[model samples]
Target: MAVRMLINGVAADQVPALDRGLAYGDGLFESIRLVDAVAPLWSRHMRRLVESCGRLRIPPPDTMQLWSEVLEVTRDMPHSVVRITVTRGIGERGYALPAAPQPMRVVAAFAPPQVADSAYAQGVRMRVCDIRLAEQPLLAGMKHLNRLEQVLARAEWSDPAIAEGVLCDSHGRVISATMANLFAVVDGMLLTPALDRCGVAGVARAEVLAACPQTQVGALTLDALLGASEVFLSSSVRGILPVRSLDKQDYPVGGTTRQLQQHWRDLGLRWSRADE
Candidate 1:
């Protein structure tokens, strides 16, 4: 079936070319998992989108209307991936913001890849990417459309055996995976690199923190991760995935990782059953 997309509350046959999101990557997006026609992490996704828009100086869209559109689009699907993209609307051929910019909202629903669910249970293999993330504090931690870093990182490996790539900042500090936030279990505590300087603060990472308050959030060096007892990564779309290997080091997906995964699964089930 052809996926449907809602653009500013109107059904669209195709995305417009003038969209700044496509032209200059001037936008933010949220990739959410829908279960039983409900987005399991809708609130967290919305919160991050709101904050990103504010930071980028883009006007916020109607949240209630947005949610309604999301539900409307995914109503028929048993399980799907919902993508919400908000752009700076159309503009003239320049970087100058339009005097009265009418921001574009795109809500799309499609069948999610089966790999998303299986990745959490079976875990995934990773490689150390050659592409390094440039530190951009202004754009840090927002899922904005500028993804060249990840694209380059992902391009490093063509082997299907590799599931994801672990990225490091220019200074060689481990930032995250190509599409997820990373967490390493060390000394009996959860350790994830602080995204204050680089990388996206994933919704799944936030949920994990909420579930386990004692998990530490701070700067993490590659050496620290290499010496850790276990490692895992998180994303809103993929939930939690244990890292089976990184570079030459390998770690088993242990009890703590399984416990957190279970917690996330329970939360997803609860959210799916909640009143829409």
Candidate 2:
């Protein structure tokens, strides 16, 4: 639990009570994986953060400054996770945003996933929750601070055996997993659900699409997901994770998953390593 948390480049314990991020969840966050004290996905995280800030109308922090803080807070750590949160600073009592809102940035570091390599090679089991994501076109792909949907969906099950939960839209179209982007291989084509209506567009998903130009993004149904030849989850920290089983049905960690994992490793995203 030896970690350092900084608020606006200085050591601090808490944010202002009137901060809009705490008041109305007016904020954005990026979880960066620091492998060997390096963040290979820093550019991707910065791109998404800038996009989210523009979408949310919050001012984006200086990319170089943010990187400096990332390294500053996570110094000397061999393997860790650095989470950067940008808030709309303190605001008035009403819903109206300030005309000149100053954004507050918080950087904190913690231990990375401790799951064994077997979890990635053999695949992890996930569950489908009853809670459906309400379509919000405006907030569709932004990783804003509001995560009550994922919180409640994750709360739907407490089985330690379940590594993650797949979420769908109100119309039963699969979107993504609770913490990672979902991907499936169907008819020898890589497919992932379109996130124009819901779900966060994870950084790792962006990388996969960039590397595998043949990948397609569209609506994915639960039946379609179950019918796929292979399934996996992508995230900044974990890289790629094959899905072994979805509830009662079983899926092997097929070649497609291995190929994508190898691609990530070749790209020098050290977090891609499934082994410690």
What TM-score does each of the candidates earn? 0.93, 0.97
lDDT by residue for model 1 (1-276), tens: 668789898988577798788889999999998888766678999999999999999998988999899988888787778889999989988899888888999999887654644456556888888888888899988999988889888889998868999899888898899988898988888888888877999998898888878999887888888888889988777667788887678888888788877787677632222212
Off by over 4 Å in 1: 116-118, 269-276
Q: How many steric overlaps are in each model, in order?
A: 0, 0
Q: List CA RMSD, all candidates.
A: 3.1, 1.4
lDDT of 1 at 204: 88
The TM-score of candidate 2 is 0.97
Q: Which stretches of candidate 2 lie over 4 Å from their true place?
A: 271-276
- Candidate 2: minimum summed lDDT over ten consecutive residues — where? 267-276
Instruction: Report the lDDT of model 1 for residue 103.
Output: 90
lDDT of all predictions: 0.84, 0.89
Best prediction by TM-score: 2
Error of 1 at 228 (Å): 1.4
